[model samples]
Target: IYHVNNWYGVGVGSVVFYNDAIDANTDRSLYRKDHVYTTADKIRAGVALNNEFKFGLITAMVDWGVYLYNPARHYYDNPEHPIYGLGRRPLFYKNDGAGSDEAFHYIRFGMKTRIWDNLYFSASAKTHLHICEYVEFGLGYQIPFLKKENRKHGEKIFHHRKNWWQE
Candidate 1:
């Protein structure tokens, strides 16, 4: 039995843009100012299981994720008078505050088998309900870093599992 959890937050500062100046006498003369902002959040939960079988190994896992995004909010500013120019004031803006909501799901299935004392092969299939989907396979050989005669069998496998730290 296994359990995993994760969370993330992202935000972008407001963006501003100014349009080129236009002749004050022309009816088409218009000054425009624009601003935009965006933000997002995500959470995930998952469980995994592994078991040894007579012919090989079997592993299965599933994860559910919730993602919320603001995508974008925009503001447009117009000048009260064409000659006065469009400043930061007189801007029309709208933001949903909480924005939009979205959900995602994922599943993974894999197996590994030892063909020989030092040789092994593995394969996995994975799918993301709303993102990416793919399948992958790999082969590997276990070479003892320390003298095999000096290490216990269980200790060797434990060392492999502890190879690196994941964030």
Candidate 2:
């Protein structure tokens, strides 16, 4: 459970990329009768299935985790259709008061890799449990104190320093 607050706007969460399918989501029904569903018949009770193993592949390293403290909710126009009329759910930082257990427990899975020196390219899906809410892509720049000199295109020189840790 790593603490992170990325584009998801989460206050607290835990994430792990097992590098394979070994890591996945398993959430159970909230049972409160107030939850999100893909259908309206109430046939599909809930989507949050905890501790369940799911198989997946990687175009890049895979990440899976739970948003322990998520205030994000799914809004519906009605409750009598199989297709959730709503499109990709909208996310907002509503308030700082949603309970940890009562709030919607969202799941996030995605792929990310460093495209260049300190630039990262990432695309991930945000879901309640298994019900995917939306997918997001982002590029971030990381500030580095240790300036690693960019190598020349055709140079055979490789800088070998004794302990880069000590600057």
lDDT of each: 0.33, 0.36
Predicted candidate 2 versus true structure: per-residue lDDT over 59-137, tens digit per residue: 2323334333222233232243344323332232222243222223455566765555456677877654455556779
Once model 1 is optimally superposed onto the true structure by TM-score, how far is the C-alpha of residue 145 displaced, in angstroms?
2.9
Error of 1 at 113 (Å): 0.4
- For model 2, the local distance difference test gives 0.36
Q: Please provide TM-scores, in order, for all candidate models, with all chains considered together.
A: 0.31, 0.33
Strongest candidate by TM-score: 2
Query: lDDT by residue for model 1 over 30-85, one digit each (tens)?
Result: 21223222122111233322323222132232323221221111122234434323
| After superposition, candidate 2 runs with Cα above 4 Å error | 1-103, 145-167
